[model samples]
Target: MKLFHYIVTNRLCHILSTIVIAILISTTCHAAKTKYIWQSSDQFVALEQQDSPSTNTVAPNDHPATVTSETISAMLSSLEIRATDSDKPEPLFTAVAVQSIAPQILQGLRQASPTEDVTFAVIGLHNTSYGFVKSHKVTTGRVYYQAGRLNILIGQAQKEVNDRDDRRLAPFTPGSRHKTSEGDWQLLPQPGQKGFSLQRKDWAAFSTEWQPPAAVQSVSPQQSIPAGLIAPARQPSPADRLIVLKELKEKGLISEEEYRSKRQEILNLL
Candidate 1:
């Protein structure tokens, strides 16, 4: 009977050991699974990857990997799409974060005394001629630099406009869309605002709230003309002089008749 009992106890221990080993094996396999963002092997594939992915039971030694420029651009494009899908009534811009900006552009912006983020702000704009409002809702624009054209974002306009007012001035609650400011501009929130504005003059605010004409830099190289010395002489062209007179008149430097007589006198030279 003692021998029989010993054999049964040994069989029970073996069964328990096998069950524990199987559980550990299953856990190891589960840990080997990778996460979507962890899949850095390819950026485009990573983004366009299964919109819905199953969580793996295990983690790999090294998982979703490095961030490439392609990944950044692709990620930005997705935000743009979200902003587009949601429409608003005021001007909007999407802000993003990066380690550093390109040097040449940074030099120009630094001269403007603009915050570093403006460097990226300069890049995101498709049209250099118009204004962009950073740190706000998407672009279903209320007031666009270009008139008579409608703009929309992946979200609402009033909320964004209000948000611009708040960030440029105060803190706003996340879900509540409407808020007041000195002028009470409507500003909306975009998840995209995360890193776009770390470079602010104020640490308390971290960034100024939205203000119109976020940045406008007009640069023109000037040819120095010595004060006392006359410009070097060249054979004067009648048409060139006429062009100058016309330009001066348009610029209100001279009267229309003055411009006409100047043109006639030059024509007489011909």
Candidate 2:
């Protein structure tokens, strides 16, 4: 009776050990399947498992598409950004003049890395209580591609309008992104706002209206001027310099003393 009991007890121990080993293998495989392709403080792009039912997952058949210059232009024109003081949102590019320089804004998205970002000036019209106002703002945007889908995040716009500097308005900032739905691209909301969508057909219209103007030649200092037609040297206005200095301070690029000194200098110029 003792011998039989000993054999049965040994068999039971072996079975229990087998069960534990199997469980551990399953847990490890599940953990391996879940990973983040990109992440930030408040946002992330993760690779989901096939069993996940999340709507954010990209379909298997939908391969990742390279973002083209046209894509960038279309995305920028479709953005519905509103200033904090404005009542209603408006397309970031309203006037043809602002749209003409869209090509110059396509930096950072075409990088070889899977994750990248770009910052550019945003010129748009906003409707205030008084009337329509033109706003020159600055914003940063991040982009990444994973598992056949593109993810984008656009930061809040900083009101950095310098009316005296036409060149500041010429630099463009690319906008945010979301999944493509029925041949249309959508703009995912920044933190506390509702999302917006734009159709592919609409992009065609925007591209046509936003054709860039012919390149202008710059006058070199070495070039000779007419005997009586010497022109005053062009320089950034005091207001423009002050705006740039303020931006540097806000970005933590300059010390308080430096910012104050530069600000005073610009003020003195006025």
lDDT, candidate 1, 1-270, per-residue tens:
999999999999999999877766764553343111211111101011111224432111111222234433322332222123335333223232111122322232223211111112111222221334323222221100011111111112223333233221222211111222222223333344432221111110112222222123543458564585554555535554654565467668899888888888999997
| Per-residue lDDT of candidate 2, residues 1-270 (tens digit) | 999999999999999988867766765564365353432221222332332135554333122335566655555555555444445565544433133333433333333233222323343333334564434444334344444333334433433445564332232223333422121122323232223222321111122123332224556889876686656665765655665676567668899999999899889886
In model 2, state the lDDT of residue 71. 56
Q: lDDT (CA) for every model shown?
A: 0.30, 0.43
Q: For model 2, name the residue pairs that clash.
A: none
Candidate 1, position 200, lDDT: 13
Alpha-carbon RMSD, each predicted model: 26.7, 16.6
TM-score of each: 0.17, 0.32
